[model samples]
Target: MAQAEGTYDEAQIRAEYADLTRELIARGLQVSTMESATSGQIASLITDTEGASAVLRGAYVTYCNEAKVKCGVPAEVIRAHTVYSTQTAEAMARACRRSYAANIGIGVTGTMGNVDSANPAASTPGEVYFAICTGAGSDARGEKNHSFHVHLAPQPSRLMYKLAVAKEVRDRLVVLLAEAAA
Candidate 1:
């Protein structure tokens, strides 16, 4: 079958999400999500699709450090690696997996700090990290982290960066889930 081609639009995202749910259901798998900056957008998108209950276990929008810790992210892990770091993303994924007992779990973390040059260089305003983890039952039982450093130079703003980061993370996860199922 030929794959569809287009930039991510609402239609494309919905279609991909539907496909993901279908594949998971067919395999008797389930998913859980941990989100920070995206603020539950990914989870909401998945649940918006019909029949998502078959594969979507639940989602946690851990928007605060305390919530992350409460939801199973270790305080030491957060201290060693900032909340926006890839390590935090991985921890979030694993924590979600353990908490929800889902076959697959995903985590996302990011920040939209001020763009001033003096700010910490390790994490930029538009940088986002994503991690996908499969449970012990799956062959892909590990975490995958991806970072998007969107340097929207001339037109940078907190809202713009946040939206860009969220969209990119969602689109990438859709592709990753499809590939993993294949």
Candidate 2:
């Protein structure tokens, strides 16, 4: 958390995700991801370490609107709030949690560094939306925890943006885990 925005190196970001993976494994919690702008990078990172199979149930790369809809994100959600909004992110998380039966589900969507050609009016460069839906909250849909929108500083590369988002998710998840344990 000490690191400044957009300044985390690849190694630091890897450690964040790897560390979070270990924490989840330790807690015997299953995790799944439905990713967009970050693609499947976070899922890939979670599976990089040993014992990942024990915790990572599945992942979906919902990079396009159709893919998101087909993967369980309601088409109506996208129609009401563009693919990059917090609503879509939350829906992605809840939908994946239900589909994969994971204890925790992560969703991410955003424009990397430029307006989206496919939806320019809704695009905001360096803006990201992410949500963490956990079993902790038994809403009508059984997914509740946290969701956020972030405007990242311009990084040197797109990879850094992805890492920044990963770090945010990891950091938030850690707190939520701690809170749940308490």
Candidate 3:
């Protein structure tokens, strides 16, 4: 679907979210999230859908590296990866699962705006990393997980960028859930 000048496709997002919620409910799986760049938007979108409580365990808005570390993301991992790499994303997801004991854990982190003095040049704006993890039953030691990195060049407005990232995260989760169901 085409996006307008500076807005996201809310209708499409809602429809997709509905499908996601349905699948999670059907599978009797619970999900939790630890978000950074997109803050808690991903988790918010998930819970906005009907029947969310059945599948959504909880969510954390770890906007700062300190908060990420507090929530289980290893400080060493963040130090090495700048809190924007796939490693940090994976660690955040694993931590979410361990913290909530949920079947699925999601982690989102990255730069969402123009580079500033405080922001490292290596972390490009509109570049985001998403990690989704599933507990492998008896062994919940962070074995089964998936991570994706996306670059939205010519980035849109801040709100639009955030909306787009949230949609991508939701769509990916749907695919993962479908594959697990099959």
Each prediction's TM-score versus the true structure: 0.73, 0.93, 0.88
Question: Candidate 3 at 156: error in angstroms?
Answer: 3.8
lDDT per residue for candidate 2 within 1-182, as digits (tens), equals 12337567789778878888898899899999999989888898899888999999899998889999998989999999988888999999988887888899899998888899998999988888899999742243655848888888888887887888888778878899999999
Ranking by lDDT: 2, 3, 1
lDDT (Cα, tens digit) per residue for candidate 3, span 127-174:
788899889432477558799898765545776677788887887887
Sort order, TM-score high to low: 2, 3, 1
Please state the error at residue 105 of candidate 1 in Å.
1.0
**Model 1: lDDT to the true structure:** 0.67
Q: What TM-score quantifies how close candidate 2 is to the native fold?
A: 0.93
Off by over 4 Å in 2: 1-4, 136-141
Model 3: lowest-lDDT 10 consecutive positions: 1-10
| Clashing residue pairs for model 1 | none
lDDT of 2: 0.85
Which residue segments of model 3 deviate by more than 4 Å? 1-8, 136-142
True-structure RMSD, every candidate: 5.7, 2.7, 3.4
